[model samples]
Target: MCTYESSSCQTGETVVIGENNPVGSGNKGKRFCPQLVGTSESFFIPVNIPSSFSLVARNIPTDQTKIRSFDCILRINEAEAGVQSTFFNESYILCESKEYMYADDLLQNNVSVSVQWNGQHYIDDPTDTYVTLYKCSVNGGSCSRCLSPEATPSFLNCGWCGTECNVIESDVCQSNRFVNQNETNLCSAPAITDVRLSHNYFF
Candidate 1:
């Protein structure tokens, strides 16, 4: 005697069903049903770093029937960095960390992000859950290293100028010295240009 609507069943959407026989139908006979969705993909980003940054996860499925809290764990170089709990009602989650992570600390650029629902279910893929860390400014590093394909992944937008690596629009490097990731040849060029002297003198 239970009737359920199939067309109304949608992800994150709920519908109620009850018996229509009418002999002894009570409130307890009604069932609350919630549509659960599976997480297809999830990814996070370091919105800001070295001071205060928000770890944001996108496209994460949510179950409203479960607890409203979830845990987000961050791992750097295969070591656990920290974990923070976040509250969300939708498919998006964010956790903010004030810990300072220097460029030297993330030189390896190996980071992993994962999330758990009420300490019960993990919602992200295990095999392809690595996040690429981007740091263009490192101590004692040359411009070539900053603009190299190996050093600067396609996702990072940075350029080299003089002795510093900055965002492409930062204008830190002069016209002739500015080299971006697109200029592959400039990565191999010498950082300093040589000037031939006509005469030699003692300082």
Candidate 2:
């Protein structure tokens, strides 16, 4: 039961599935499940979940035998959630769509529910297993900028200029050229380090 905190989630936590399948030598058949330990802030769940919230399960291979089968059940508080089984591979459980919720009350009270794998497994690995979890973006859809702090978190307005507004304009360079509107014979160029105009005008 390891707990952590990220920039977006305060209750980011992880649990090792090795306790269930502790038969193999080394990290052959182990799974890891990451879940939000607390509900201090709004966290993200995989958009791959079937409903606005549903339990998804995937059997990822962790050993050579690939005899990995478990009666894994997901619970949120006290209510049993619908567990949808997808695919199982030799490397690990591929229950990409099946996820376990923490509790039913938590899901009902909150817009989103934090999930965790708290069920017993048939095969217990000698070591530990890790389950992969994908976080959602600020929009609760995709994970475009969920992991990166420097990336733009939400949609940004580009204004009428569009992509041009995203670019930073360099200093203007003065050139000795003729102007159509003004007879000053001075022109301004883009991205010039120095100015060499004979006359300068303030506009």
In terms of lDDT, the best-performing candidate is 1
Span of 10 residues, lowest total lDDT, candidate 1: 27-36
* lDDT digits (tens) for residues 1-203 of candidate 1: 11235354565443343466444233332233211233443332322342222334443445555455566666764566545554444434555443424245443364666666666656544344544455566521776777776875545566777677755444454444767778757665564668787687888
TM-scores of all candidate predictions against the true structure = 0.43, 0.23
Distance from true position, residue 64, model 1, in Å? Answer: 6.6
Residue 202 CA displacement from its true place in model 1, Å? 26
TM-score of 2: 0.23
Q: Write candidate 2's Cα lDDT for 5-70 as tens digits.
A: 223323322233355555434322234442222322332343223322222333332333422332
